[model samples]
Target: MSRRLVPLALTLALGLAPVVAVTTGATAGQAERRAAPSRTVDLPDGWQPEGVTTGRRGKVYSGSLADGSILRLNPRTNRTVVLPDSAVGKPSVGLDYDKRRRILWVAGGPEGEIRAVRLGTGEVLRTYTLPAAANDRFVNDLVVTSGAVYATDSANQELGVVELPAGLTLPPSGAATLLPLTGELVYQDGFNANGIVESNRGNWLVLVQSNTGRLFRVNAATGRTLQIDLDGRRVRNGDGLEAKGDLLYVVRNANNRIDVYDLKRNVRSGDRVKVIRTPDFDTPTTATVVRRSLWVANARFGVDDPETASYWLTRVDR
Candidate 1:
């Protein structure tokens, strides 16, 4: 073992898998914390890309709100590849991928629809519709757990919990059952629950309300929730949430920034750690963590010409 401390230059190449430029004898997860330079990729416009997710080997996926198409993008190559027969359910706002089972879960907007699509063949494995009030639903973000997936319903203030059988794959017969939210997480007039994620151990689920920018900790089983106090401050316009262990990233759309926090004591109260921002942010709707970097999808909802070929995804170094 060497006892000398030397500055190490790590490079995580963009592509299906990261090709390191320097050797530091660090695991991929550890290298992610220190490696990986940030860059932004231009997305073909008019797709209205919103949902962003990462599969193994740093393969990124985004859904089109305008055409219901799912695009697989290689960040390392800056190319978009189409998945065969994969387009289904327009406005796929939020997405999650199950690497073990090769499943991609999609959440639809307004209609409150959910779809389980097989990754390789682009087959629709199952479809579940979440119950919500008429004309007032935004089936928002979702988090995949070891045994289940918890999704947030913005309009109705509920969570649709879909339990995965032992294989981490859902049968066509499986459905999304409602976990009615109560207590402090009552119905706020608009966009109540937007982004969602589970704790590192998959023990509890974290939810963010878009309108109030409030955070809630929920028991994964019983639907019990409590407000997470944040030092007497509010995260207004909070959209998407990503949690890794005790660390959390809150995406504030239109604010063009993501706030990082330390979630201590089961995320009861979070201490703000850092603020990530970029001039490339154009109403970033959601973000996904790949290794130690954050890939943000620009929704461009504020732009008058969302159809213009000017949308893009920005990479942020963490």
Candidate 2:
């Protein structure tokens, strides 16, 4: 998270020294070699990306902390565009797209709001404001579900959930409800909840606590939660989370690494399979799987010159 919450959007200002790398799963024996699965793409230095997601045909999108905008990055063509919005300065911390409905749901920080926009057209259809609470609200990350949408409030202990009506897209008047996280999810210091994802089974919700680096499984229907065991190792500095099949990716920003996990079918626990590191990472925040690669948004929260600091996304092949 940022000074906006404590700071704004993301506060991963660890500013670790740069560690660049170059790796390809190749050897010089054969004339023909396997395609390399890792690379890096540079963004405008000040984009200050905290979230990343993918749409059809490997299209990648990142939300901005600098201007609260969304940039569509085309890896194949090396192009980027800021989506059209009536208000250009609203912060979008985390977002997910509903491909079936062509809806992009975004988390609005501090203001405690969620916006639903038409993906291709960049038209904001509805904005749902969650219930006001006494505690400060930092609407951090979110996942769009089959029947509803779930958003994590890092400044608070509960989840802001917006239930969708029978329609495929967000209803014009949908209201957001706060799902108080109970059971094993006892709130502690530092930004609590950050990245979130729906399990492959779609029966449970998976979340990462940024401060404690603990994973928790929540029953979608009940507010019940269970701490996901990770062999007693914490995923410290966890920011955004993304899951594909049995694979779960946890972006640990300050550590400048994405911790990969092989998940059990139940989604209650997982094993850290590998740690993906790229030289391009400058406190990378979140990532999305596109085809055979994972695209990460580098927030670069530590750079002194956010106005001039160059930002980029690391592409790691599967």
Candidate 3:
């Protein structure tokens, strides 16, 4: 793969701020005394993990593609614990943490189901099945907002939304609504909407097309989309997304790198400010930001003997 450096003048013209280092309150002497956390953490063999998210008290979570099992890892201590009562035959694609309810919303790939699992205990509170026709349905990724949880169906140009009531309780089964995607985005042969996130203070949703590497900004209420301009650059093989304020991280699985973009206030456009590449990455599919560091999961797609292959998470400093 070729690496092109964007000119500083052009980046500024595109409304992107230059990357700067964040300062800690500790002095240089004290900072040197404290040891940094490990950059890599191992997962169980044949885990085949994809989605990743962070919870309270520095807890990191990921789900297995092989068996749909959920695992919690403590990066500081390098400890891991698999949550019990997970669906064995299904696959867990994407995950989001609900702070208010202390639940983890899991995106069931191919099964077209959404599960709300209680934290620590892994007790499945509810399983909401999404409506699908004769065509295949893939619940690729999801994002949880204040009002609802929106999931992307990669095989179709629509989103599965599960509305949360005022009490923030889970609804009954088979209650997920399919919101058809309109406007600029068109479904292609392969995966369409892979990863999703909310931007511009929950007014707009950002989705990434895996095959085309294009980004779209969708209206939260209407589901109308508009293509985001990236100055003629494309994030080919984009798999997962992580957003912090105005900055967006696009994980390019095939490229083994993460593209960092500075999204504008309207969420319709952005500029790539940085590219993160590390030796620890091996087809990373998704990531979550924890304590100013990115914890990325290696899916290791197309590997021989996947049932016995090794998997791990790489920590990249932001």
TM-score of each candidate structure, all chains considered together: 0.84, 0.87, 0.87
Give candidate 1 regions above 4 Å deviation.
1-38, 132-135, 173-175
Better of 1 and 3 by TM-score: 3
Kindly give the stretch of ten consecutive residues in candidate 2 with the minimal lDDT sum: 1-10
Clashing pairs in 3: none
TM-score, cand. 3? 0.87
Question: Is candidate 1 or 2 superior in lDDT?
Answer: 2
lDDT string for model 3 (114-138, tens) is 8888888677788877886556888
Q: Rate the local accuracy (lDDT) of all candidates.
A: 0.74, 0.78, 0.83
lDDT digits (tens) for residues 103-191 of candidate 1: 88888777677888776655678878876465566788888888887788877767887778886546564457888787688766656
1 or 2: which has the higher TM-score? Answer: 2
Number of clashing residue pairs, candidate 1: 1
Which candidate achieves the best lDDT against the true structure? 3
